[model samples]
Target chain A: MAKYLLLKHYRGAPDPVNSTPMDQWTPDEVTTHIQYMNEFADRLKETGEFVDGQALAPEGEWVRYDGPGSPPVTDGPFPETKDLIAGWMVIDVENRQRAVELAGELSAAPGAGGRPIHEWLELRPFLSQAPETAE
Target chain B: MDERLLRSLIPDTLRILIRRGADFASAEDAVQEALLLALHRWPKDPPRDAKGWLISTAWHRFLDAARSEQARRRREELVLAEPPPGPASGKDDSLQLYLLCAHPVLTQSSAVALTLRAVGGLTTAQIAEAYMVPESTMAQRISRAKRKLAEAHFTEPGDLSTVLRVLYLIFNEGYSGEVDLVAEAIRLARELTKLSDHPEVHGLLALMLLTEARRPARTAEDGRLISLAEQDRSLWSTTRIAEGVNILQRALAQDSLGEFQAQAAIAALHADAQAPEETDWEQILQWYDELVSQTESPIAKLNRAVALGHAHDPASGLAALAQLDASLPRHTAASAYLHELNGDFATASRLYSLAAQKASNLPERHHLIRQAARLSGTDANGPWPGSGE
Candidate 1:
């Protein structure tokens, strides 16, 4: 089995086809979206595919070490200006095709007006344990 | 309790049982049962003769199993059919087992799994965990492989090259979960040498040993790939290097040269050097030339170019690489290295990033991206502060 990371972006991605802001949606709609995501994770766990899922706070600051014994420098929490990561779910599945199929389902999570979000989720494969016979 | 020693005896004992009268499947099951019994009993009461003990125990297990399944009349016939220990056969049955598992009808994956179980003496659960497959799946694969081996009507021994290929694949998988495949491959290769004194068998063992000796130096503390030129020589295992070189010399004395021998020769040169600058790239390039001609493998050719770059001019190396298909996995990486050597950091950095994107493994991708960052004058000593790297 191979592992894949399903990334939901807060920004940086090209505007998703269904560009409805979560805050603008009805409270019930937001609840539905959250439930769909939770259900997806639960289903993956049942299949022995779920590895982990985590959400990130939108406000993030970039930091760098100045030098030894020096205070580190930090940048702004520019949530709106830069592409921010929303959250990610890691799954261990059979193959790339299966990973894509799951990603498609995730993208179809309900949104405003109870319609599919069509959000573009980034699907990245985890570099597996190196197989024999290196090409 | 010297489980490895017990494991080594597994195939030989199984073969002995089969030769006496036991069917292959029954014999295998008996051997497995004997091994489990050994694991439980050996530590408390070690066997004076492990192989003999296993053989007798497996034979008894086989008899018991056969008797339980059939009538008393058939059990008596099985007892009568059993052969007493006699002078060893000129052709070792263990060798036959190798040939059987390496049968060409089986795919590489199946052959590897079968050889690990029947020949290398790994348990199905251990093999499954190593390959990240379910135990049931690996069990099925091995059974299917054995069935395929049984069905193939090989009038003579199967291809020795196929056996060597499977062993090499197992070695390359390295250690994960319960199985240390590198050690397993080395153990199997050593067994192969005992059964058949073939030069290529020695060559393959030597190659694996020489390469594995340098494994400790192949990665940084942070798990990034360390190029040969940068690795600390002190970390290389001298004992394994000596053994590998000794084996290679003996194989060379036989004068039946093969691709594995040539590859080992290259590895030996790398191992022999005190420092990267002391490497005999000229001799390495010559060995790679022999390797390219013998195997006609693109990976060998790509490596040959890298050796060419170290031995001669970067331009010459680039010229050789240009002849290769660009779509090849390592082509961009090779080009980037050669370009970097030629002092074209601009192109090198770009190509390094491109190679990073195309890399199949995390360490390799990180290494490539680090190379790009270094070339582009970006501070890479700090932790990766962004998502991509």
Candidate 2:
């Protein structure tokens, strides 16, 4: 069976509209959102289909290796970028069709104020040693 | 008289012609033409000596094609000079084809196709089917590869590693169209082993066999992906596993380890386990370490992280994963798994969603989305009814 990595990102949603800002969202709202996502992950784990997953901080540096005797260079946090990645997940499954099914569900991750984010999640397969019977 | 038997004899015949100085491309085309002729003629009147019939017919066809392409004067001169008498039959000439196919001039893909056709005796259609390319395209590829090799003066033989790589690519293609590439690869590997004494060749064959043993239990009834932990051990093929293990043991005894040997060692460890928990993660990790040293591939390191996760703490796996660049193949998936093991559900879920979207093939994409849905407590129903899609 092939495995895939599912990347989660926000799309088409207005940036935090509340006066309180995301950091000041009521503790209950924060708790509820965390619980909701947690419940989802726990359910997957129960099925034994869950492999692993993680959230990413938006801020990061891009490093480039030039060559021998060349110093590595770094750049980051471009102000012009729009699509911000929130996090990612990985699962081993039989094929691509199954990957889409799972992506549809993740696209509905609950966002700020208990609204479905309908986020854009990208799915990528892990290319491992082809299964023994593949050829 | 069966098609299978006829196909089985193709490699040997092609091998004989090649040894006598035919270039890989010409030798393959000649052999293929001979097989086509066999398919037409054998049913009506099976040849008394099938190998001899193919070698003689293919040899002449090869000469005819060579003669036709030359200037008339040169053709006449060559014909007047007379060709070498065909070697006595039953010489297992397939090895020569292997060497020619592995000619240094041919790119990996062309070499694989030529090898499969000439040494495996597989039809061009079969080779094309295996790669999911149009038959015409494959034909062009094979022809171009052959022409390139001919121009490069690629008459010298290649090492067993080249042949093994070709077989590995063939096996990796999985089943496509009407071709059973896995079985074909195994058959070719077996044939190659008979012709060479390389331990790595034996290691590669062993690795392929061991992995193939679990094909029956690799997927669900509905064609959904099944994880190793979830696979039914009972369904694994004991006979193939035994054969693989035996070969692996003999290869290991040589102690001149190669990548295939390391991979086979890992597979052997997997086979030894009766259940998922019983799997020897430490041994697998060791093999992966050896593999990384030998191959220095990011994928090997990624695999090693997974082994570490099972052998030690998930956190340790995550730590190892963190050291790898995200662009490395499977880095995201490996990170997601490591996070999931660390109880970072939100991160895991998000990664799953990303993986599902980025998936290149249908099965892997579907599997990723399923993971996302299960984590989020949402419906996991996908567009496809069954996984074979």
Candidate 3:
């Protein structure tokens, strides 16, 4: 089996089929969208596909090492320009096809007016343990 | 009293309890309690009918558990309607039990732990020891898996591939503490052979046997991985190799070739060679061709590239490698080797160092680093003092 990272981006991804943001949606629509995401995770847990999922905080900073015994340098928590990761769902699945199928479903989480978001999610494969027979 | 025989009877007894109205969790508990009782009592007074004894004891334990529950009214009704325990559907129940434990609803690790306990008939302590987990942790994992599948009704037969995958995972876990997972997997596969005559089951057993035969030579004294060509063939287990070959031959003769059978054929070719130079690379390439056609796995393609390097010229191997995605793990290492074979030592050295940087395991990373150093005419422990600025 292989693991995949289903990444949801806050800004980098293309526009969704349903373009309205969650904050602009009606309260009921927002509730429905949240419920949809929760239900999707629950179903994945039942299917033994879910490893973990979480909504990331919007604020983040970049840090880099300078040298030995040197204080690390930090960059701004650029919320406007940087390609921010909204959150991710990590899944262990039977194959890449299954991971894609699951990502497609996650991308369909309800958006404005409780319509399918049809968001673009970046599906990335996790590098697995090296095969034993490899030299 | 035969411990293995008693353990083998566990699934049958558990099925009897479930059919007689015990819930899955309670049935498992009852079976476990009955087994513990047998361990203590059977030595002093062995029973003539071990299966019957286990079934009866487990049934009583199930009833006791139900009676102790708060829903006494429902418990009494179930007890009244419950039929006397009879011999379970024998082979069918055992096979179904295997599928249930390996249910898709359970995680791989959970399925493995459950299979070792519920179907393989090993104790929780034994399974925990084998996996090198605390008993409580293994217990929680098994219980969580059981709960996840509690509502799963087996209207359709369990998938054979899933069961095989779980068993293969077990075999891959190797040995730990007092338990040998490899031996345990072989035992479970042998049991599976009795329950179902699926060729793939036999194929799996053969594959495990063949690969395990090389375990003694798989690692060097310092725990570094040894490539097959560099392994000391004298250290290989002849007995295991013979058995594996015999099983593989029987499977291949069936004319219903599957992926595992093809893989076993490749392993068999390696075991057949007396020395690395004598290896039948051409025959191995044929098996790889079959494997690639049967399963379009990238891993298979990577391996085929390695075989191509040996079967043909290095240029041909590099050409084949070019067809695959360079992003695949170990792609650089394979490229480096082909370059080295073609006398492009500088490029090979660079690629080896790049591969070392990306290596996932310490042993493999060290091996790649050494390869890079040797190609660069530097000492493995450290670079030569005047080698670089």
Candidate 4:
């Protein structure tokens, strides 16, 4: 069977009620979010559908190459950009339909106010091998 | 049933489950359960009819979930009262699921995930590994996507081109986790081609084949990246190249040229030549021109410059490079390579160093650094040329 990747995005999603800065959020909220995400992962594991997931630091550097006698330039955390990604998730499924189903469930994860965050997600499929004849 | 047979039947089984009105989410869960059951039972007492077994088992699992969720009561009634089971009657449902997954309401990423789950029969964990994300994150992503599908009004099927693009991306990833991405991509592409006779499908398949034919030579013995020019020609898969060529020939015969077909045509040119020097660079440049006409992308322009260097004068190639946006990834490296070819060592060295410093990934950085070191006649321990700091 083929594998597909489900991507989640928090595009202007409402901040949870306990939405303090990362450092200021009550320990319980932070712990709860982490624990919930971890527990959810375990559930996927039990079903043998668990793969891997990670939280991305919402910052990145851009590097550019200048011509000969020119030097490379670097940029980071540019002030103009607003749609910073908070984290991501990936899931394997049979087809696009199934992937959509899983993404729906993930969006239901409890957020700041212990309510569903209704976050946005993007699902992409992992390309597999060439057909046998092609090989 | 042999593992191979079981694996092959997964897509078909998933199609059936989805066709039976099992929402993409529930259908996937049911399929996963069926696969798990098969892993346990099939190894011991193999099913005489593997597809039948999977269909029956997955169908039952879907019913069980539907009953528990208390959703789709009307649909449940229809499923329970269906005609006695014969050969899988769910092919239509599966096709519909493909359409729904590719629905325009959802983002491309969600559509791809939904397609893989409903059509490919993979699990969230597998997809997560493929994307280097946690299973929980993947779960949430898929769940959100399905919810969108559930709410979406998919009046008509999506364009085949969109679906083909998604599958092409999958094949390009090559491999992840325990999954061979190339094989998965081909399987999906083959299935897609059966669903639609679009020439681009063939074009995509040919493109994948031609590119994959060089897989053996794409990497060095120690997993280092090897440029196409430096690849060991002997290791290139002639069989794959032939297959790609044959497919491209058929696609071209249609007299309709698409971006994929154009790209595949370029690949075919590379494959036809026995040595790099023998490559039909002029013809490839023509194809690139066609590609640019079809799709105006900076990366495409950058690639065209490389072909220009080979097909015409190096100075013209440099001029082409100058037109591209400097911020584009690999622009510096491409320019540096062109400079190196033009016998401009100082320029090449500087560009290489800049490219190396700006490299996003480790392997690319290492490669650029090596080039810089070589051009500047320096060792690793010493300060890079022009690095006064």
Candidate 5:
């Protein structure tokens, strides 16, 4: 078994088939999209593939230590920032193919006009301890 | 009265009940209940016939369970058709349990969880914690596995190789958890040895031991991955090395070489080295040749390229790598290493960064980032290069 993180980047990633933003979509479309997400997670739970998932807030700022005596520095949430993550889902599956398949299915969640979003999902596997015989 | 001794009795204890015509799921439940009773009463009131005590208790429970279910009559007939438990059956039961738990129809994860529960005698919670899954999720996985086996109706013992593969997965596919999967794998391998005369079985055990011997120096106190070239040779377990070599020699003498034996030979060569410079890369490459020929596994081919770097030269390694699929896991890392060996620091640094981006685990990613930063004249402990988190 292997664990994979399916990442949903709000920006930086290529445009989806359905490019309309969620805020621009009709209220009915938004509800249907959300329902699809909930149903997808429930199905994964039944299959025992889902591990964890969360939707992130759009707002964020960069924080850093200033110096030995000063408070931490906080930078603006610059509009110019190109990278933005919408959410992520963690899954444990039988193989990479299964992980990719599930991610593809999730990417098919209904979007604007009640059609598939076809969003690009970044699938990454978890690094584990090198097996004893790997060396 | 020892916990390990109690656990050691589990597989056969459960198997005997199943052999007496109880279904796998019911037999398991009955055995669990019997085990709980043994744990409670064994310390103060030990049974003289522990195995017999477990079987009778579990069998009674199974029968009682069958009575409550609708298919009670048919199940009772199945139990009645079987011969009474004989001493000769115990040895085969253990192996059969391994076969049943690791049946090919089930997914790898399901087989692993089932094996840990039925053969390794671990609690569902314990298995859940080890795999880093929720207890409910693990429970579902195990029950689904049992259901799948029942549907498959596979009664004959499965191939030994499938069981070996599952055990190998158990040993190798571990990161961090309360349970020590490595030791658990070795224990199961040892148990297998008691039932079979297969040379490959010993080969697997030897491979695990020889590899594990180097674990003392595999990581630093702060949990950083240490390259093999930098590992302290003095920290290696000589006892384990000796035992492993002895086991490998026995397996090799049979002259029926398999993939695990070939890999073990490579590990034995590495273990034989007293220093990094003293490592027998030529011998390692040779064993890798045997391994590649036997399995044709892509990972083995990738590893052979790495061995070529040291055995011949970095140029040959780079040429060999260029011929293979670039998308293979660790391909970028191998390229970076060969470039570093060829004194192409810029290329190595770039590839290291790329490899870091593709790294699957946090520690390996951190290590690769550290490598990339070190080569590029940046802070070795710099923040992530391409990670979104």
Candidate 6:
């Protein structure tokens, strides 16, 4: 099986079909959205497809080594222009088609009027160490 | 006791418990407990009869567990089977374990996990580490697999082919990392040979051995894939190749040819070659033909087209390729190679780039990118010749 990552973006991606900001959404709608995501992951777990998943706190810093002896440098929690990862789910699936299908289902999570989000998700494959076959 | 030898006793011990009417799940739990005790206790003072010790301990464990859980009172009725066990029951026990582990009700992944767990006798954590998955996820998977098996009456023996297919799947999916999963697969397949005399079993083992022999030269130190033709011939393992060829010859002599035997035959031919130029593509092509005839597999047909290209001419290969769907996983790559062979480097370059873009794995993508660069008359490692930005 191949592993795939479904990445949710706080910024940087092009506008999705339903482009309503999540903060503008009603509390009930946000609850519905979270419930849908949890159920989706639970279903994948039952199907033996889920690997690991977690939503990240939006507040984060970019750090780098200034030099061997200097304190590590830190940037803002998140600037408007900086690309931020909102959350991610990793799944192990039979093929790319299955990964795509699961990603599409996840993208259907409820949004601002409790309607489908249709949010653009960045689906990336995990680079595998193992090669299954020669021919 | 050697852990491998101790593990070898598990299938029979588990089988005896099962035959005495323990349900699959609890029996497995009991066997696992017994194994843990053995691992903890055996090294200091080894048992005189390892299998007997395990069976007795697991049986008592199952009884204790059954007694403690009074709500499921029906288990009390499952006292034991009346018939006396026979001498040759050992082989049948392991074979039955193989069949049950590869039950048709389970998906391929579940089958692999169950086979490694019940037969290979690996811990869930060990399996998780081996496959590079989280332990909780693997625990859930194994439980789900067991639940699926319970729904299907959990682990009744089936046909040998199903087990052979599972072993083949494991062999293909393996690579060395924390646990050398390929070696584990090879070890399990070797163990399976004693349990069944099926030619396909030997064929599958031979196929794995032959393929594994080339692994040393298959990839560069920097993790770049080296194509078979580009590989250093001196690096291939001759001992494994010899063993594989010997096994294939014996299987072929049985005169019951299957798809795996055909595949093994092709692998044997490739192993026989001392150099890229010495490969007998014609014979390889014929074996692919045999494989195709046996299974009507599209992959086999695609491989045959490649062999056709090398054996006859690129034109013949292209003609054959035209009959197959272009959407097949390696179709574009195969087409690119044939195009390059037929002196259409421009088209070959374009197809190679496309194939690289579509590659599912990193090594293959890198290899395809290199091919694209090669045909476009450029070096892969440096900047483009005429463009400086």
DockQ: the better of candidates 3 and 4: 4
Give the DockQ (2 decimals) of all models.
Answer: 0.03, 0.03, 0.01, 0.02, 0.02, 0.02
Q: Please, what is the whole-model Cα lDDT of each candidate in the order they appear? A: 0.81, 0.73, 0.80, 0.70, 0.82, 0.79
Q: Write the per-residue lDDT of candidate 6 for residues B4-98, one digit (tens) a residue.
A: 78777777778888777787777888988898899889999899988889899999999899888767564546444223444647677768778
Pairs in steric clash, model 3: none
| Interface DockQ of candidate 5 | 0.02
Tens digits of lDDT, candidate 3, B220-274: 6545567787899999999989998998888888898888889989999999999
| Runs with alpha carbons beyond 4 Å of true place in candidate 4 | A1-135, B1-4, B71-97, B378-389
Best by lDDT: 5
Q: Write the per-residue lDDT of candidate 2 for residues B141-221, one digit (tens) a residue.
A: 888978876677644656667778888988987884687888988988887788777789999999999999999998765
Q: How large is the i-RMS for each model, in angstroms?
A: 16.4, 15.9, 25.4, 18.6, 16.4, 21.2
CAPRI class of candidate 6: incorrect
lDDT of 3 by residue, A1-135 (tens): 899998888677787788753433443554456566778888999999998776554457889998999999999767576776767889999999999999898888876567788888899999989999997
DockQ of 4: 0.02
What are the clashing pairs of model 1?
A: none
Candidate 2 error regions (>4 Å): A1-135, B19-24, B43-45, B70-73, B76-93, B155-157, B378-389
In model 6, state the lDDT of residue B184.
72
Cα TM-score of candidate 6: 0.70
